[model samples]
Target: MNPRSTATAHVDTFARDRLPPPDQWPDLRFDLPELRYPDRLNAAAELLEGGAGRPVFRTPSGDVWSYGELRARVDRLAHLLTRDLGVVPGNRVLLRGPTTPWLAACWLAVLKAGAIAVTVLAQQRPSELSRMCEIARVRHALCDIRCVDDLAEAGVPGLRITTYGGDGPDDLLRRPAPSTPYPAVDTAADDVALIAFTSGTTGRPKGCAHLHRDVLAIADTFSRHVLRPRADDLFAGSPPLGFTFGLGGLVIFPMRAGACSLLLERAGPRELLPAIAEHRVSVLFTAPTAYRAMLAAPGTYDLSSLRRCVSAGENLPAATWRAWYERTGLRLINGIGATELLHIFVSAADEQIRPGTTGVPVPGWQAEVQDAHGRPVPDGEPGLLAVRGPVGCRYLDDPRQREYVRGGWNITGDLYVRDPDGWFRYVARADDMIVSAGYNIAGPEVEEALLRHPDVVEAAVVGRPDARRGQVVVAFAVLKEGAERDAEALRAFVRAELAPYKCPREIVFRTALPRTATGKLQRFRLPGDGYAESSAREDAGSPTGRETGGDRQ
Candidate 1:
C-alpha cells in the first residue's frame, strides 16, 4: 500500500506538531557518532531486522521462536493490520494483552505498519481504557479475546476492535499467514511510534509520545554501555511490556545485543525463581519488592545461574540491596527511569553501585539536582531532579508539556541530592514530601527507616491532614510473618532511626501496600484525611511541600 499521500503525511504530523518548540527541547547528545539515526527509520526494523536463525523468545514450557520466525509472524500481522483492518499511517491502534509472545509480535507489527501503538496494562479496567481511547482518539484496537467485552464497554466511537489469542477461527494467531510478506513502512526518525501512558498516581493518565529514534537511542545508550549484555544472555523480568521499564529491559535491550528473553505470563517471585533455574536465565529485571520476596524462598530454587540483576520501577532500599547481595552474592543494578523520558536515564551497574544511591547518569544523558529556578543546587542539598538526554518529554498534545519540559530540562518529580562523588541519592517524590509542625520530611526517608526494622516487610508514608499541625506523617506497613503490627513499636523504631517528626505519627498495618502494575509504590492511594487533589494542586507551588510546578507537570 502507498502510504505517502499528502493526507497520510498530514495525519502523521499530528504528533510532531504537539511537541514543544525546538527551543524548549532538551539538548540531545549521542557520544558515539555511529548512534546517529537516519531521518527515515522504523523502530521495528531496528529491533527485528536480521539475526536470521537466532533464538529470540522462549516460553516457560520450553518453546523457542527464532528471530526469523518472529519476523515472519510480525510480517503477517502487519499485513493483517494494514490490509484487513485498514490501519493507515499515524492511526492510533490500542494494543491490549499480557506480555505474551503474540502480544510482543503485535506491538512490533503495529509499528511496522506505520501506526501508533498505544499499549495499556492488561489489568487496566474499562473506565481507564475508555479514557485512554477518548484521549488518544484511538481508531482501532487489537485486544486479547478476554478483554474485548471491556473494550466494547468503553464505547469509543468508530473504534474497530480485533480479537487475538482465543478459540475463535478469526483470532489473530489462527488467521492464515499472508502469502507475501509486508515490508516495514518507511517512517521518519521523528515520527511518533508509541504513546505510553503514565501510571496516573495523582490524577488522569497523560500520554507520552516517543519517536522512532528514541526507541533505538535507549538501546544504544543504556543497553550498550551499562548493561553490556552478551548474545547468549537471557533477559527476564516481571514488568508488563506496556511499561517502558519492561519494554526496555525485556525487549529492546536484549534485541540490541542479539540476546533472547524469557517471557513470563506471570512474574511473581514464585514463578520467577523456578523459571530462572529451569531456563538458566542470565539477566533478571524486576522491582525491589520481588527481590525481597525471592529471598524468602531462596533455599527452594537454584538461582546460581543468574549473573546480573536489574532493579527499577521503584526506589531500591539499601536494605533490599544488602539482603539480596548477602544472599546471592550479586549486586543489583539500581536505576531510575520515567515514561516521559522513555527509559532509564540514571543507573549504576556492578562495581559502580552505591547501596542507597541511584548512581550517575547513563551515557548520553545529563542529570542534576536543581532548585525552583532551574539552577543547579550545591552537592548534598535536596532539590528537584532534572534530566535531559537523547529523549525528553513530548506529551501527546497536552499542556502539561510546558510543565514537564521547562528551560530545556525534564524536571522529573523526584527529590534527589548529588553527593560530592557524583552519585545521586533519592530522597522522595517532590509531591511526597511531608510537612509537620514546621519541619519538612521526605516520605521515602521514613519508609527507608521503617524498612530497616527487621519486622517490617513493606512500608509507604504519606502526609495525613492534622487538626493542629496541618499535616502529619502517616505510614502504612506490611509486617513480616508472625510479627506484631503494633503501631507504637513501629513508630518508636522509626524515631530511633530518624528525627521524631519524621517518624510516622500513626502506623496502619496492611497485608499489602497499593502498587502499580510495574510494582511502583502508589503513595496517592495511602489513606489520608481529606488530602484532596485540589488542595495538593494549590500547594504544588509551596517550597516546604517542595512541589515545584515543573516537577508535578
Candidate 2:
C-alpha cells in the first residue's frame, strides 16, 4: 500500500477503537501489584536474551546490531565498568551524551552492574553538570568526546571519565572487549534504578529517584494501555536518553515489549523524519513542536510504517493535532508525564484519544482535582491535579516533598479541570496563572486562542505586575511568515473572541519566545533582562481609581 493510503487505514482503525467520548472516559485505577524484580533482574538479559540473532538497533551510519551482538557488547562494557572503572553496587554512574545504541546499552549495563544511573543532558554546560554531579554524588562519568571538556571544567573530584570514539585517544577505544557475560545482581523492588533531575522552573534541580518497580510500572501502565508496541515494531524518538520521556519511549517500553528500536546520534525533526522513512520505523515519540515542524517541512517523506505517534513534554494544542492528522492521517496521542512519575501518568491510547484535553489518567494510577487546602473540588472547577500509583515519587532530602505529597497523592504543580464524564483538561501551572483585577486567567488558554489567528505562529502569555490591579496579562507573540504584527489590532481580535478581561492588555512582537529544551514556554524569561525596569515603569504609571472588575471571568 502507498504511504498516504496506509496512513488513512491507520487513522481509521485508531478513530474506531481508540477515540473515547470526552464525557464517557473511565476513571483511572491501579488494581495490580507493583512490579518487583529478582535481585538479578537485568533488562538486557530479560528482554534481549532469546532474540540473540534478531536485528535490534540500526544507526544512521549503517551500523546494525543484532540482539545477541548488542548483548555481547553490553557484557564487555559492564565488565570494564566494574573491573577497570571500579564501579560497584549502589554507585552512581553519570552518563552524558546524545541518543545512540551504545548509550542505550550503557544504561542497561549500569543497571546490570547494580549501579544507579544518573543521565545528564549532553547540552548542559560545565556549571550545570558540576552541580548535578555534586548533588547525586556521582563518582564515575561517561560521555562523548564532544562533552569531555565541559565535564573536566566541572572539576568533579575523583571522577573517572571514559570518552566515546570520534575524538580523544584512540588507544582507549581499543580496550579488550570482555567475553564473559555478566551475571544479574539481585536488585530490590524499591532499590533506586534511576535518578532523574527535574527541570527546575522554580529553583535548583532536584533528583527524583525511581525504583526498579517504577520502571516496570510505567511499562505496565502507559505502555500497556497507550502504546501497545509489538515485538516486531521499531521504536524511535528525539528526546535525549537522559530525559524520562526518552527513557520510557526508546528503552523501557520497547524492551518490555521485546521490540527493536532505532537510536539517532542527534535527534531533531530534520534528523528524525529521515531516519523514520529510511528505517521504516513503526513508533514515533516526540513533542508537539517537532510534529508541527514536520508538517511544515517542504518535502514529502514516506511515514507509512508509523502506526503510533506520542506527544508529551508540554500540552498538545488542538490546532497542532488537527494539522498533523490532516497531513498524516494519524492523531498524535497526547500524554502528560514528569520526572517524578518516571513515565506518562495521564494519556490516551490509540482507541481513547481526546483532541484538546490531556486524556484520562492511565490505568493503575489515581488522579483527582483538588483545591488549595487539599479538598476535592467540584467537577468542572479548575483545581490542583494530584496523582498516586504504584510508582510513588521520593525526592532526595528535599523538604518541599511535604508540599508535593499531601496524604498519599503527588500534587503536580498543574491546574486542571475534570469534566463530569472523567476527561481531564489542562489549565495552567499554578505559578503561571495570571491574576488581573481579581480575575484568574490561564495563559495557555489565551495562547491557544491567539494561535487560531492565521498570522500567529507562536504565543506566550505572562503576568506583568501592576500597582492598581495586582497583575495584568501581557502576551508575547511570533508572527507567521509574511504576517504583520500590529499590537492594537491583535488586542482587538482577542477582545472579540474572549471576555474583555481575559484578553491581553498589551502585545509584544518577537522573533521567537524563549522555551525550555522540552518545549515548555519559559514565562520567567519572557520579559528579558529589562523585566525589572519594565515592571517599575508599569507600577508607577498605573491608574489609581479602578477596583470594579471581580474575579468572575
> Per-residue CA lDDT of candidate 2, range 1-553, in tens?
0101111111112111221222221222347653434433444456556477777777888887888888887788888888887787777889887888878888888877767789988877787788777777787887777777888898999888887655444323457766988886566444566788875523567777665656778888889877888989999988878888888888888877878888886777888888889989999988877887687667879998898999987778898888888878887889888777788888886657888999998888888999999899999999998887767556655555666677667787888999999999999878788998999999988988887777878788888888877888888777777677677888888888799999987777777666555555556666622234421122212111211110000
Model 2 / residue 207 / CA error / Å: 0.6
lDDT of each residue in 117-167, candidate 1, tens digit only = 999988877778888888788979999987688788878889988999899
Backbone clashes per model, in order? 0, 12
Predicted structure with the largest lDDT when compared to the true one: 1
Per-candidate TM vs. native?
0.92, 0.87
Structure candidate 1, residue pairs in collision: none
Angstrom error of the Cα, residue 360, model 1: value is 0.2
Positional deviation of residue 284's Cα in model 1 after best superposition, in angstroms: 1.1
Q: What is the total number of backbone clashes in candidate 1?
A: 0
Best by TM-score: 1
**For model 1, the run of ten residues with the poorest summed lDDT:** 536-545
